[model samples]
Target: MSGYVRPGNSQPALLFPFIAGVVVVLSVLPLVRLAMTGLSALAAGGAISVLADRALWAAAYYTLVTALWGTLISVAIGAFFAFVLTLTDIPGKGPLGFLFVLPMMIPPQVTALAWVQMSGPSSPLLKALGMAPPLGSPQPLYSAGGIALLYGVQHAPLVYLALRAGLMSVPRDGVEAALLSGASPFRTFRDIVLPLALPGMIAGAAIAFVSCIGNFGIPAILGIPASIYTLSTLIFTKFSAFTDRTFGEVALLSGIIALISVVGLAVQERALGRRDYRIAGQAGARATFSIGGWKFIFLPLLAVLLFFMLVAPFLALLAGSLVPAYGVPLTFQTLSFHAFEEVLLRQTITRTAFANSLFLATVTALGLLALSVLAGYVLSRRRDAAASLVASLIEIPYALPGIVVAVAFILVFAAPLPVFNVTLYGTIWIILIAYFASFFAVSLKPVVSAYRQLDPALEEAARLAGAGFFTRLKDILVPLIAPAAGASVILVFLIACNELTVSALLWSTGTQTLGVVIYNLDDSGSSDVASALSVLVVMMVVIMMLLLEGMAKHLPAGVVPWRS
Candidate 1:
C-alpha cells in the first residue's frame, strides 16, 4: 500500500515490461503452445485414434485409481499427524515433523528403490535376515496398490503442511469454551476442530491427488516391469516410441493430465465454497489437549511410524549400497563398498549426473533469485491488476506438473530459434531453461514476502536522499531480504537436485541428472550402484535441509517449510 510508483516513473516503465516479458517467455508462451497443439490435434480428429486406444484408456484408469487411493492414504496419514502434532502436547514435535517430511524431500525413485530393497525375495536386507520370500515370487510392489502406497508415503507431507497451516488458526477460545461446557474431547474435536480443518484437508487431498497423477518415478520403477502404466508413464512411453504423430499424440495426453489436474483443483474449490472459516479471537496455535497418560502410547506409536517411514528404508538402502551385488546378502563377511566405489570412481555417467544436477541447481537457484529480487520490487511496489496477473502467470508453471512443462518446452525449443538458429532440444541448456521456468515461482515467493513486510519509509527516505533505484535495492533492499533470499536459494536447490520429472524428459546423453541416472541404473539392473548413488543424493538433500533448519530462526516464519 505504501510503495506506490508515481506517474512518469522510469523504474516501473523499465521493470514492469521486462518482468512481463520474462513471464511470457517462461510461463505463458509454453503453456499456450501446448494448448494450441492439443486443440489442433483434436480438431484434426487425432483424438479419436489417441483416445480410443485401449492402452490409453487403461493408463487413464490406472492414473485415476492410483491417484484416488493415494490421495486417501495421504490424507489419512497426513491428517493424523497434523492433528496430533498441532493440537496435542507431543514431545519432540520439531524433530518428528522433520523426520516425517524427509520422504517427501527424497526422490521418489530412491524411495521405491529403498522400499524394494527392504522387502521381497530379492531384498538384500531381508535375505540377510533369512526372511526372504521364495525365489520366483513376483514382487508385490509391481502392482496398483504398491504404487499407491508409495505415492501416499511420498506426498503425505503436502497434506500435513496444508492442514497444519489451517489447524494453526483454530481459535483456542472455542476449544476452551467447549471443554468448560463439559463437551468430551471427541465431541469437541468433531464439532469445533473438524469444521475448521476440512477445507485444508480437502485442499491437501487435491494437491496430493495432482501430485500422484504427475509422479513418474514410483510407477516407472514399480509398474513398468509389471506392464502397469499411469498417464505420465504412458506419455513417456509414447515419446520413447516416437513417430510422425508423436507430437500430436503426446500433446493430447499432456492435455488429459492438465485437464485432470484442473478438475482436481476445481473440486477442492467447490468443496470449500460458501464457507466462512474466519476466526474472531486471538489466532495462534497452541496445545489444546493434554494427553497426560496417553504420552507413553503416543510416543512409541510415533517412533514406530518414523522408524518405518524414514529409518528402516534408509538403513535398507545403506545395506543395499554396501552389498557387493544386488541380491547378495549383506553380512559382515560379504559387506563391501564396491557399489560406492563403482558409482563414485568407476562410473562416468554417475559422475556426470552428480555434476550436472549440482550445476543446474546452483545456477537455477542463483539465477532465479536475481530475477526475483527485481520482480519482487515491481510486485510489492504495485498493487494493480497487472501485478496480480503477472503473479498468477508465474504460478502456472509451478502449479502444473513438471512433465507438462517439460513437454511444453520440448514443443517450443525442439526447432532451432528464429534468430539464434540454435536448438535447445537434446542439450543441457534446454534442461536449464526448463528449470528456470519451473522454479521461478519458488524463487520469487520468499523475496515477495520479504518485500511486503518491509517499511516503505526506509526506501522513501533513501530515495528522497537522491539514491537511485538499483542503489537503494543493493544497499537497502537486498540486505533486508538477505535471509529470505538465502532460504529461497536453498529451497530451489533442494528441489532441483532431486528433480526427476522435468529432467527425465529434458535430459540428453551427456546431461543426465541425479534423478535420471538413478532411475536408469535401477532400470538397467545395477541396483547396488543405483542404491549407492541414491544414498549420496539422500545425504545431499539432508545436508541442505539441515542448513535451512539451522537458519530457520533468522529467516521469515513460513520460509522454512516442515517447521512449526
Candidate 2:
C-alpha cells in the first residue's frame, strides 16, 4: 500500500521495486562472497597476517614510489599541455590536442608493448643510429624506471583532461584584473590561477595515483620481467601463477589494498572539506596569452613530451605488429600483414575476446546506468539516514582498485555458500559483478551531480499534481537527466572495455576479453599478435566514442558538458 501505483500502466508498480531488489542482490553477491572468504581465512590461524609479510611490504613501497613519481610527472606534463592548449596560440593546436589525449583511449598494455619493442637493442631507431653498444645485450624492458616511464606516459592524458577542464573554468575577469594591475604572467599564474586550479590538480593527481597503483597490465608486461612487483602484480600472481594458489593469502592482501585505498579517500575528503575554491560563474570568452619569446622553448618541450608519451608507443605498436618478431630489425621487405591476418583469421582467440569484451561492456553499461539512476534519485530526494548510508556504502568500490575487487570476488565466489550450490568461480557472472563493483561509482557520480543541480520545487510541484514517483521519474527526471545517464553509460562501457586488471584475474578461459587476449599473447612472447590486438581494440574504442558522440548531439546541453 505504501509503494508506488501506476495509473495508466497494465503492470503493477510493485514489480519495479522487485526488479530493482533482484538487480541489487545480483550486483552485490560477489562482494558478499568476498567478505565470507576473508572472514573464513581470518579464522584459519592468521592467514591474513602471513600474507602481508616482507614481499607485500616491498610491493607496497614500490607501488607508492611509482605512483608518486608517475603522478608528479603526469601533473607537470598535463599542466603544461593544458596551459598551451588553452592560453597559447600553438600551431596545429586541435590536432595536437587530439594526439596528446588519444593515448588515454588505448589500453595500457598496448602502450607497454610499444615501449618494450622500441627500447630493444635491435630497434630500428637504435640500430640505425648505432645508439646501442655492439657488445651490449638488449636493454631489459621491465625495470622500475621502465615501469615509471610507462605509467607516466599512460596517465599523462588523464591529467591533461582534468587540467584542461580546470583551465577552461578559470574566470577571465580575475586574470584580466590581475594583468591590468601590472601583475606579470608568471606572478598571476602563481598567485591567482594556481590557487583556483589547485582542486583540479589534486583531483587529477589523486586519480592518477589510484589508477597507477591499481594498474595490472603495464606492470605485468613491463615490470614482471625485471622482477619488479606492485600490489596489483602480486594479486595477479597469487591468482594465476600455479605455485601461488593461496586464496586466503590473496584475499588478505587484496583486503589490505582496499583498506589503503579507503584511507586515501577519507584523507582526500577531509583535506578538501569546506574548501570552496570550485569554479562557479557564467561562461565567458576564453582568454589567450601571447607566447612570443618562449614559443621556441615551450613548443619543443611539449612536442618531445607528446612524442614519447603518445606517438612513440603507438608507432612502436604498429611497427611491431608488422614485423614477424620482437627485437627484430624492421624493413619494407620484412613487413607484412601476417600478424593482423593471424589475429583475425587464423586465431579464434582475438575474435572471441572481442565479442566477449563487447558483450560484457554493454551489459555493464546498462546495469550501471539503471542502478545509478535509482540510487541517485533516492539519495537526492529522500536525504534520510538510510539513503545517506547507502550512498556512502556505494562509494566503497571507487576507493578500491579493480585488481583488489577481482581478488575479493574470487575469494568470496569460490567458497561454498548456502543458497547457490555451485560457486560463481568461472562464470561470466563474476566478471559482470566485478565490473559493476569497480565502475558503479563512475555512473553514480554524474547522475548524482546532475540531480543535485535540479531544483526541488519542480519535483514537489509534480508530486502535488498527483504525479506518482514512477510517473515523475519517467516523465520528468528521466528526460532531463537522459544525457547524463547516457554519458555515464558510455564512459562506463569505455572503462569496462579497456579494463584489464579485474578482467585479467576474474576471467576464465571461456571468458577471455580483448584485454586478456592481448595480455596473454604478450606473456607468451607473441608480441606481433598482441600489437595487432591492441590496434584492433583501439579502433573499436574509437568507433564506440564516435557512436556516443553522435548520440550525444541529440541530448540536452547540460548533460553533454559532463561527458569528459
- Top TM-score prediction, candidate number: 1
Candidate 1 has its poorest 10 consecutive residues by lDDT at 1-10
Prediction 2 TM-score vs. true: 0.86
Writing each residue's lDDT as its tens digit, candidate 2 over 1-564 gives 344445544224555455346435544555666666667778975574655588788888888788778878888877778778876777767667766767776788877877776776755444434564453674666677777777777787777777767777787777778899999988888888778767667677777777788877888888887778898898787666654337767777777676666665565566667468755443544556767878888888878987877677667777778888775656777777899999889998888888888899999999889888887776665556755656655666666688877776776676655676877788888898888877877788878877887887787788779787778889888888887788888878987988888888888878998888898998998888888888777777767666666666655343433233
Off by over 4 Å in 2: 5-43, 47-53, 87-95, 124-136, 241-245, 270-288, 292-297, 449-477, 548-564
lDDT of 1: 0.91
Cα distance off (Å), candidate 1, residue 188: 1.1
Q: What's the TM-score of every candidate structure?
A: 0.98, 0.86
Query: Model 1 off-target regions past 4 Å?
Result: 1-10, 285-287
lDDT of 2: 0.74
